[model samples]
Target: MRKLGTARPISQKQSARKEGTRSLAKHHHKSFAKKSRSYSSTTAAMAQQNLNSLLQWSTENTVAPGATQPSSDPARQPAQLDPALLAQLLGGPSDADLMRQAMTAILSPEMPQDQKMIAWDNLEQLIESIDNAMNLTPLGMWAPLVQQLDAEESGSRMMAAWCISTAVQNNVKAQEAMLATGAVEKLAGLVLGDADQGVRKKACNALSSECRNFQAGMDELVKSLPEDVWKGKAVDAAEMDSVDEVIGKLREIAARQS
Candidate 1:
């Protein structure tokens, strides 16, 4: 009877030990699963944050001290183009020479930000004033500017796109020349890939202008743009709207040409 009692208690202890071991194992598994889930959620949230940051525009404003303010009176604003300088640039110096000088001023690392802005403004006006005479061919004034579309400085890229738009607007010769430089593809890439809103907008403007009333230009622009860009993959809502607007304009142009 004493042995039986001792053996029965031992059996109970062994059963309890087995139950405790199973419970511990179950707890450990649950803990590991919870940790894995937590780690995955954290990683996903971090990735989402990074994606949002990349899509968001910088809100920093750095206005130059002496920058001109907007004026209600049209005459108060500085002339966009200096007539004498335009004539000299177009007729006196070769397009290559003028482009080199403008690019040097615009791209110089040591140049003041304000000065760079001035250079861009001047370049835009010069290209606009010259119209089709700016020559966007391989050896034209716009060759260097097209290369600047990929510049490290966002401001430079924006200005370059703006200049290309101004140069190609309503100028079939300039459009053809720009196309020859493979600018259509480059501009489309900017429209789809550039993070800067200003740069993208300017690139879209350039594409719209290039495609206006020109069948060949329209074809080139459409072909250069990727289907994914129009589908709005990875683009923010606002940026997607901008892309849509550009596509709408291009389609309109195509319809008109057809």
Candidate 2:
């Protein structure tokens, strides 16, 4: 028996304490569950955002199907990237863009001659590679550089011939493309008549490269060089035998191919 609410049964006191403890525990568990759900939702959203960014980056940076080098492996998993790093990767210019800018600098009449020379210098380095040399045709670079062979400034003419020589050297496909632009005639004209010695030499180099191992190019070159001018009859006294030597070497190459 209980004494008028002053003293309770030990079992009743124990039961009340147990009920309070259970309620507190249930409330704490509910709060924890809510927090856990929120955390899960946030984590999932962040992961999805990162996945989207990576997808976008991959799409934009994917190499064309016919690229000389493979850009990615299908088996490779997407890498997690930082936001700042992703931005950087997206903001950079592509190889095509750089090439277009260089072409513009080379072909634009309003561009400074010095800048044009620098552009040719840069292109010379690039075209040393077979892929880069092959790229000249599709980019329409061959035609413009060929046209530049007739530029008023001897320096410009020299660079144009030099660029052509560098691009076509040991690159038969590039040589064929240049030949299509009718560059051999202009190049021969430079070799015979250009006042600048450097221009003449570079022009001769281009002619030699174009004609070597390519029968059509060699025929075109022979056709372009007037026999009288190259045979030492019409050349200036100061022209020495250097021009004749080049012409004779080319004739020998042509004769071998025939």
Candidate 3:
């Protein structure tokens, strides 16, 4: 029989077993927490990686190579003129009608890019035909043509410059209108500032044509000509030749006028 007030002795093996179980539980708890932290860190890193990939994809798709950034100015927005509408407008009732229609089509924002180019080429041909006829007395056309010198499309600007150049060819009235409408300043700016060599050449030719026999045109050209023309730096070799030709013609015109 057990004596009163005396407790039974716990076996060393049982005590050690209990201690081992507690130690194992603590170790498991620590390991579980470590694993939870690791899982959380991995998930966050993976989310960050996914976010970076999405940004990269967005950037790659948003802008095309060599594409010009969009201008904020509404005036500089891309033309929206419909090609069909352009064709309809170009269906001429008269020379004045044709000129007005052509100008409208060129400036309209609805025109397709490819068709816009075709329209410009056709307009140039039309202008050339009118100039050859020597009956292009519609001085009103000069104002819109001058406005196109500031068109957002390089093609539009080039065609406008070419048309102006052709219109002034042997036409005194057209040249006077060109000067009066302040086209000389815009043409000079194109010559000095346009990125396209073709555009620069066309502007140069237009300046020369306008200034050939007109003293006022020559004076304006002299005033508007960039100093870089004399410096000869940054000008392309072929473009420089055109520039030199225009300068020589201007000099000739000045001498004759003097």
Candidate achieving the largest lDDT: 2
Per-residue lDDT tens digits for candidate 3, residues 12-102, read 2122222222332343456546667779798578657656655665665464678775578665454554443443344313444444444
Report the C-alpha displacement of residue 157, candidate 2, in angstroms.
Answer: 0.7
Q: Where does candidate 2 have its weakest 10-residue lDDT segment?
A: 1-10
Question: What are the per-residue Cα lDDT tens digits for candidate 2 across 1-258?
Answer: 111113233224322222322333343456546677779798578667767878887876666788654347754434456655454345433334344555666677886665565555555655676887888877877888898898898877887888799888778898889989999999887776677777787888888777666667766776676666444233321243644465566444333321
Model 2, stretches more than 4 Å misplaced? 1-90, 229-258
Q: For residue 19, what is the lDDT in candidate 1? A: 30
TM-score of each model, paired residue for residue: 0.51, 0.57, 0.51
Better of 2 and 3 by lDDT: 2
Candidate 2 C-alpha error for residue 58, in Å: 12
Provide the lDDT at 105 for model 2: 63
Residues 1-258, candidate 1: write the lDDT tens digits.
011111223213223222322333343456546667779798578657655543342222223579665678665554444444453333333334444445566767886654565555545544666532454454446677788988888877878888888888777788778878888889887777677767777787888777666657666765676675354233222244644565675444333321
Clashing pairs in 2: none
Weakest ten-residue segment in model 1 by summed lDDT: 1-10
Q: Which candidate number has the best TM-score?
A: 2
Q: Could you list the CA RMSD of all candidates, in the order they appear? A: 29.6, 29.5, 34.5
- TM match of model 2 to true structure: 0.57
For model 1, how many clashes? 0
The predicted structure with the larger TM-score, 1 or 2, is 2
